[model samples]
Target: MVKINILYASTEGNTTSFVTKLTDIAAENGDIVVARCIGEETDYANETAPFVAIVPTYLTGGTGTGPEVTEIFTNALGDYIAFGRNRQYLKGVIGSGNRNFNVQFNLTATRYAQRFNVPMLFAYELRGSKFDAEKAYHIIKPLFGE
Candidate 1:
């Protein structure tokens, strides 16, 4: 089975719940899934599995971002990339945001994907729906050669 590492950051628990469902789905698909919340753990550079990040957008006007979450990932992965470590691991991202934010919606995922040169697999509004979880699974499964 392929191993998948998920790093998540949640402000009000919505992103956490959404990631939990996605983790269950990934597990059901026979992939080994390991998850860590940003503040709870610091090091992501040692992860040997393909990486996935689930984060929520905290939009400050038009500048959409997840400051702490992004910083954690950036610090770890930036060093890894600079040192040419874990270069073969595939990376994926998912973002949660309020639709009322308009153009800023899901911008966190977008920015992260660009930074890492990975794909933004899915972007969900608020807590996300059942359909969004399923779609995320489908997108992620194939990356594991499932």
Candidate 2:
């Protein structure tokens, strides 16, 4: 069976909802998805399989139109991946955001991919529509190779 590992962080339930749909879709299609959501406590796993990370954008300072997209709102995912062991297993990144945020949209995912030297694989707006979930599922499925 095709298998994938999904590591993600969500605030305000949007990213969690998206990952849940992605996981459910994988199961429906007879694929395997081992998914984990970061929480208030730092959780690290010795991930043996390749994994993709998903994060939503939360930037501090300035409106989208301004030049001051300064900081990421949370460091939880950063710390989770910073476990040193975890970074090697990361395969790619997906992100969620409000398009209205402009340059800051999906900023966390983009930065994570860059920092970890992985591909910026996919992105969806906010919680993502069912169509977006299906699209993400297809994109991820191919990565596992039948």
Query: Which candidate gets the maximum TM-score versus the true structure?
Result: 2
Superposed model 1: Cα runs more than 4 Å off: 28-30, 40-45, 61-90
Local lDDT at 74 for model 1: 31
Candidate 2 lDDT over residue span 1-146, tens digit each: 78888888887899889988888888898988888887558556576777888888888777762447654645778778878698998878899899987777888788888889989889999999888988998887877777
Which model scores highest in lDDT?
A: 2
Residue 44's lDDT in candidate 1: 40
Give the clash total for candidate 1: 0
Per-model lDDT: 0.69, 0.82
TM-score of 2: 0.88
Kindly report which residue stretches of model 2 are placed more than 4 angstroms away from their true locations once superposed. 64-73
Write the residue-wise lDDT of candidate 1 on 1-146 in tens digits.
76667777776889878877887777787776677776434454545667677778764433434453334223443344333455346477788888887767877778767877888888999988877988887877677665
Candidate 1 differs from the real structure by a C-alpha RMSD in angstroms, to one decimal, of 4.3
